[model samples]
Target: MDVLSYLATPFTDPLMLVAVALGTLAGVYVGAIPGLTGTMAVSLLVSLTFGWSTNVALAAMIGVYIGAVFGGSRSAILLNIPGAPAAVATGFDGYPLAQKGKAAQALGITTTMSCVGGIFGVLCLAFLTPLVSKISLNFSPVDYFLLGVMGLMMIGALGGGSMVKGLMGACVGVLLGRVGMDNMSGVVRFTFGSTSLMAGVPSVVAMIGLYGFSEALMQLKSRDFTVVKQDVKRIVPQFKEVVKHFWLTLRCSTIGMVVGALPGAGGTVAALLAYDHARRTTKNPEVPFGEGAIEGLVAPESSNNAAVGGAFIPMLTLGVPGDAITAIIMSALIVHGMQPGPLLMQNSKDLFYIVVSLCLIANILLLPFGLTGIRLFAKFVEIPKGRLFPIIVILAVTGAYVTNNLTIHIGWMLLFGFLGYLLKKFKYPASPLVLGIVLGNMLETNMRNGLVAFKGVGGFIGSIFTRPITFILFLVLFYFAVSRMRWWKAMMSKIKGFFKGLFTKKKA
Candidate 1:
């Protein structure tokens, strides 16, 4: 009857404990493979568990949700392929570390940090749900628009030092994303009378082609077929390493939790925001970002896992779901004759706490399950190039097709793959392009909504200054935009040098 008893319920029941453990285990592998998203996995599990007891069904789904989120990092580290959209930022530095024979180290950190973030999120869910949920309800269209712009500005961080090229790549991606019918207006934009294009570009397929298929293509051009042995000697990470990045992990986890609590804004947005924050806040990472920076791994991994807990804040506290996965989960609760929201706490007290405890348990389970696969997962890099490229290409094709069961998607994959290869040849960053597509819809939709609410472009622009949240976001956006400029850096350098010279003369 007490909260402690409810929290301990899962651990007390052997059936529930085993269900959570097995679900976690299955989720890890499912999420590691491209095209098998957590949304799909959780949705499938929900249907199968419709006839099962409520407790076991809830435990199983919760475990899979946590495991899949963490599992996405596995592919990001090993193959430069992010198994889920949330892992997109993870692959930025993960694959680079893998190339340097540190895949094990990367995996270990992601696993441990995921646990830290997961627990932190669950704690927040337990104590701060009311406060967090209230804040989420206050987000206006202008605020969402600003959030999208903030995400887009990460192109500066992702551009590999070429802002112009990054902008160009992002613009191209925005066009690609526009191919589908407009969600608000319901009018087709660029389908060109082709029904297949009606669905627009699939982000997962794009990722598979850009990172996976294109990476394989780029490697083949080198004409080298030798397999390189990755060092698996130090698979387990050191405690000091975890301690060193704990501050960063905590900060990103905070970002994840807050962003996850917002409706329609999920871990993808949270992960990107955390990555940009890490880029700006981390003065001097041991390695530069996009080149195996440990901070890169710590930021996104921790934030995304933390988001899993944050997502529950709204789903349980209000009838509103935070993201697609949470929406499915809310529906599952409905199927069991349990409605979520304010009444959930008073009515289904045991069920609510059981979900919370399972999330905590699943994340803790991430450690052993995550680490055990390192030696085996690292072997991916050791496969001969001649053989590996074909496998990657095959997987990319399969994953792309499996997304919507449409052959045309495979054609789109090849086109994106070609585009990605050309971008690589030109030294342009493919990630900015991907980010453009990922944030394009959110940015466009919110901008349009804000415009309609304000009734004109002038009003929409004016609305930025009319509100506290928008003004703050505008200031942050301006800072990011200006700080990354070459002229700004040059001017700052000159000013600093002049001051240094003046100080030196005075000291003498």
Candidate 2:
């Protein structure tokens, strides 16, 4: 359906509009808060929405989905804290811009670009999903394996200053990922006989430590953050500047949507992949990518929002919950006496229509709410580091403790936090390690499953080579690895030459 057609259908529906507005507002607020996230917000709302009509529930859900993604930029730009994991890269550049007394302008730029990114994602969801879903259906074990490998390559890209540090970090993450019972043998790998370890280290706790606590410590070490009061003028983004990065924004949106559609992947992965993709594609990448790259802000915000739509594609059509949020939606469907999947589409067309309509409407409603909230949200940067760090530490502890309501998880978080601090000191990129931990079990189990399904190692390799998609993915990864190696050598050579030249000049 056309954009106008989509909106016109809902023009007379006051309740739908209300649901949309409320959802968007909730998303923005949930996303702007330091520890609150889009996933948590939607999950929390699932219970509340159970009694509402599908349209109402979905409108609120989708609205929060968009708002939370956008809300992440608030903390990212202002406090150097990403409201959501997707906004991690955004903080790198967004906070830097805020520090430069361009808080209002940065907020304006982020909100505007985020709006564009959201629209871009919505378009992809509306148009490309059918075609892409068909392609994804063809993904085999080898293709998935290659995809996992490529995803890990993001560590190299994200850990820009040091490959050694990045690889070490990734190794740590991989080792962490290897914890818990083996998928094939059912034998516990790294649990050390602890019942909690049997389930494995929670990625959320690791994420909290890696991004939250580690960041809190770093902030504590720095001198007090100078909160500059800037005139909050022209909160709207410059259309011309957005136009300049149109291609980049489009690419990021595509990345977000595609990554989001994947069954288990979420915004954090999409954001990281988009950030790496942007870094690889750009000629002169923004200097402070992790510290603050406007493009980083743009990529993840677009991708995560798009991912929401992408997740729905599978949930509505295939009966698969793509992520934690969709899982809740699936439960909501059960609670409402409507099953989600192919049958739901066929048997309950109106409900399906409402859900799809809500997603599109949520994207539409995001622009105004996001743009208007920029000024107030940007003020988050003004909070003293002293206040922010303690709060972060407390939240980190609470978030970790709440996992099992056990003090052990809190201890685990502290241990990881200390390790994170050490990794930071040594220039190791902790994210790749986290990704490895997250994906390791999947990689191992899937590989073993593929092997068993094929009946042997030879059969697995033969199947991989025979499958076009799998073969292509393998080749792509190979080429990327080689290219990265070459790039690393070139950078090392330049560094060596500069140092050598300086020594020679001194001797003369």
Candidate 3:
């Protein structure tokens, strides 16, 4: 359908527009806070939209989805706190810029890049989902397992300062993810017989604790702090700056979409992966990553926004939830009596198009609101940590508790909170742990499926060598492992050698 036709549809009713605006606004604020997530925003909206039309409800939900993901960069840049899991990578450089008194510029630049990434992802979904979905069909169980291994290794390589700590943290995450039921046997593995344990630890609660509560705890540790000073002039980012970083923005957007399209890989993974890619691909590796590189902000901000669009492709084409936000979206669709599969496309073409169209609209709307909001949001840096941390602690507790309304889940969050803080203290990247948890089930499921397809262990092993994709994935895994081990030493030696050569040349 044409834009004009879509505009004339019932989905474009004033009530729907109002809903979209309100939800988007709410999403930005919720996501700006360090604990509330896009999933939570959508989950909350689900209750309020029972009486609304399907398109209206979807428009509202999508608005929140788009806004919340983009909103995460606000805290990431301003407070050194990642407002959401996806924004974790943003803190690598975002906080540094805040300390440098360029928080406004960083926020504005990140917001613009995020909008570009979101729009690019939507375009990809509009045009390339069929092809992307087809590529996913080629992934065998071995390939998926290898992919998980590679993803985990990438996190290990780039996570904090110590590889061992990062790996341990990642292992902890995998163990936590393994707590509920065995994939093939349907037997409970780690659950100690409590009925609540049967359902397993909630990913949201874990994420809130790891990314949210941990941040609050860390802030509480520092009684004396300096607030980020903002300059309004910097908040209105220059067009030239955007053009200069166009390539980085594009690359991160592609990374986000590709990662997000994968089932179970969400914005958090996408952001971290993009950050790793940015670090590797940059010409000057000396730009101290944790010291506030614009590249850091650009990487996560762009990728997370792009992830939203990437997430919808699987939901629309394969009936799979691309991420937790899309999972909520799937539930919302079911609530509206609209099933979400190939049949939905054939039966409700307009509804599908309406969603795709909303993505485009939401991307456009995010820019002005995002820029204006950042200008005002920089003011929050003035809030004292004593007051701010308490508010953050409450929000974190509330967000974690609401997941299942169980105190045990809150306790699980606290456990992860301490774990996350210690990991951070020891220079371990907590992101790898998150990646492991998200991909662990896929790894196990795919391996079982592939083994069953092969009819035996021998055939399964043989297929690894025979399947070209599987072989390629293995090669990538091997490369990542060896390369990660040598990266730091190699880079340091290279720097040392460069200086020696420069001195030798001068002496000659």
Give me the runs in candidate 2 sitting further than 4 Å from their true place: 1-9, 76-81, 98-106, 181-186, 222-234, 286-288, 402-404, 487-508
Best-fitting candidate, measured by lDDT? 1
How does each model score on lDDT?
Answer: 0.88, 0.72, 0.77
TM-score: which is higher, 2 or 3?
Answer: 2
A best-first ranking of the candidates according to their lDDT comes to 1, 3, 2
Candidate 1 overall Cα lDDT vs. reference?
A: 0.88
Q: lDDT tens digits, residues 1-508, model 1? A: 5999999999788989998998898889889998888888999999899998778888888888888998999988888889999999999999999888888888888888888988888888888988998888877788899998888888888888878888999999888988888999899889889988999998888988899988988989877777667888886678899899999999999999988888888899999999999998898999999899999999999999999899999999888998888899889989988899988888888877888899888988888888877888899878888888898888888888988899998999888988999999999989988888888899899989998988989988998888777788899889889988889989988999999999999999
Say which prediction, candidate 1 or candidate 3, comes out ahead on TM-score. Answer: 1
Residue 41 CA displacement from its true place in model 2, Å: 2.5
Question: Tens-digit lDDT track for model 3 on 1-508?
Answer: 3645854563447776766676676777778775577777798889988888888898899999998998877766765556677887787688777767777888888878888999999998878888876665566777766766666766654566677777777778888898987767889988888777877776667766776667777768867866545666767667887887789889999989987887776787788778877876676743577787777788888999999999888888888888888999898899889888767657776776677778877888788778776656766665676776666667677767766778888788888888878877876776666666765776778778878987878988888899998887788677666655668669868999999999999999
Q: What is the TM-score of each predicted model, taking all chains together?
A: 0.95, 0.86, 0.84
Ranking by TM-score: 1, 2, 3
Name the runs in model 1 displaced over 4 angstroms. 486-508
Report lDDT (Cα) of residue 250, candidate 2.
81
- Highest-scoring model, TM-score: 1
Q: In terms of lDDT, which candidate is stronger, 1 or 2?
A: 1
